[model samples]
Target: TMTIANSIPSEENNEYCNQFHSKYEPKEILGRGLSSVVRRCVEKSSKTEFAVKVIDLNNLDTNSEDARQDALKELRILRLVQGHANIILLHDHFETEAYIFFVFEICPHGELFEHLNKVVRMSEKRTRGVMRQLLDALEFLHSRQIVHRDIKAENILLDAEMSVKLTDFGFATEVETDDCLTDLCGTPSYLSPEILVVNMYESRSIRVYGRPVDMWASGVLMYTLLVGSPPFWHRRQMTMLRMIMEGRFSLDTPEWEEVSEAAKSLIASLLRVDPGQRLTSVQALAHPFFAKQELPCVTFDRRTRFRSAILAVRCLCRLHRAYAMPARLELRRLRADPYTIRNMRRLIDNTAFLVYSHWVKKAEDQNRAALFENSPKMDLAAQDSG
Candidate 1:
């Protein structure tokens, strides 16, 4: 590795790059995705580590504007919602004519999906605890008029302490609470029924979709966590859409046998087909599902060879949904990114590290104070109390 420069003296560094090379040296790559890659980097001055999300604008899938906008949207959204504990911090942003760089806090534990792969099933206590943090972050985003169109296990990052930090706001958008957005965004399986055109098969009309989409995805994530698979997973897009529009997911899986009724109820309300009927972030927090639960460890009753085989297959199918959207099409009204053989290998091989540290009891006082120090806690607290 080249030595960290004493100073990066260049015209663009003076304008776009934020003393980048002079202060930090790029290290090993941490993760990869469709159009971007994250690298582990360290600050020479402080020896502090961070993840630099690098996007090469030229290679950023030119077929559609959504691919490029996802990058810009992430930057804008990060600027808007940076202080929440459960949201990843964007320490700095740098740009050149051909590239955009986002300096984020190092999430050594990669993603929640990787963690689940190892632990198999999470106990209700752990799942509820995570839901609290996830909802806390979601509540803040919704209050700021921002909707994180993408909410999945891979997009969520984990710090060393196991604190859930929602990441990847590339598809996020800000809109008025009462208005509707007409974009078909987010991963296929995690998408809410309200946004799909086919959902209005009987009475076709453009509908304004909004925050409830994230709530629906949260339901998918919650169900995936408890049962080891997504509520919506199928081979083809139309097949998946049909199941999603019909709300064909159920809590009848064998793994859900030991799961609680209250948890199932929350998932039902979140995965509602009608946006008007879905739970808001605040309402989800107050639901009985997030209430304190006893017996802190999760138990997966089936470890038989057959069950393992089924889980492995389901896991691959779940991963496919992330990259299943086709790349380009001349659909009458809508445009989509071309889907060649782009993410075929990722499904069979990709496993993000989802490890996180349980909040240390020794620093309980400090951690608790820091949790809401600069966050939008009062709004939710007041609403819950009322």
Candidate 2:
């Protein structure tokens, strides 16, 4: 477990010494990945909390200029993308001699990975909601010509209402066309077959694959959500690569049987071996699975689940900052206390239900009124079209 040390007065030798301190006070370390460490910080002026991803360049494999170029590319891509709900908002960034700092929206509930582990397989409805949010984010990225090479549960963050925030653009790259890319990157299990086979051994002379890589990852995520594990998992790396090449998957599991056929069909479409045949974000959105669902109702009560979760996290964060205690200790205490988690979950559920119900009723009323008002116009259009 990562520990958060008390904030000590910065010495002149500290790498962050040169960077201008934002109004937000530094709080605690969130988690560390291969090249970066995330810390929970708050703006002193606004008292708004944020997550800061501090990337240590020294840790990167700098044997060649390729590593530097990739790092610079990620920074550039993130800077290019602005406000989008499904995407994690990047507030500000700077760099020092040792590290690059990226301040982002603080997600309280943590990674989707943890959430998936805690719950049994989510319902098809819940899965659809998450998929919708993810597609929205991905669609936005694809529109900007950015391909998030890595898309997995761990990279998705959840707010209090369990709203999805697509994050970690470390492996993302901009593409000019639907070309096959030979970059051997991303988590092993989520790698598309073309990437795994073509990119791994043949370092050069491989085609440039585009956005489909992301779509493939989305399929893997869908599979994990519905079945509770990756479709392809092997004890050996060689076997896993072979399985991926063969496009072999088994849907005979008991858990797989329980998932809706519509959801399974969508996953199958997304997991197509040929990138061209895979479902585009827009096509996936138009599928009956998503089309049948009502527009997401945004209500104060509906927002409650997330609000309560955020509040609890904020409270814990405040306590951690004031007391200078380890974050793991705080999390353990909160997690151990069933009352805290349950109350928070209930608050979100109840609030969401109330908000959704109110909106639905309002929509029906408005819909009826609109039908009467536009009756003549509707009849004319129907007749003209006919």
Superposed on all Cα atoms, the candidates' RMSDs to the truth, in angstroms, are 19.4, 20.6
| lDDT per residue as tens, model 2, 34-106 | 6777888877778889998877666776743555566677778888776888888888877555556788998
Q: What tens-digit string does per-residue lDDT give for candidate 1 at 1-386?
A: 63212122344455443557666788877777655677888978889999888776666547435555667777888999989999999987776665678999998888887786666457888899888899999999999999998998878888999989999887888888734687677777788887885345557553678888899999999987875657776646688788998899878744466788999999999999888889999999999987755886766576676798999999999879866975553432121221122242122212221222243122213221122123122243345568
Steric clashes per prediction: 12, 17
In model 2, how large is the Cα lDDT of residue 374?
17
- Model 2 misplaced regions, further than 4 Å: 1-15, 18-22, 63-69, 200-206, 293-386
The 10-residue segment with the lowest total lDDT in model 1 = 364-373
Against the true structure, candidate 1 reaches a TM-score of 0.70
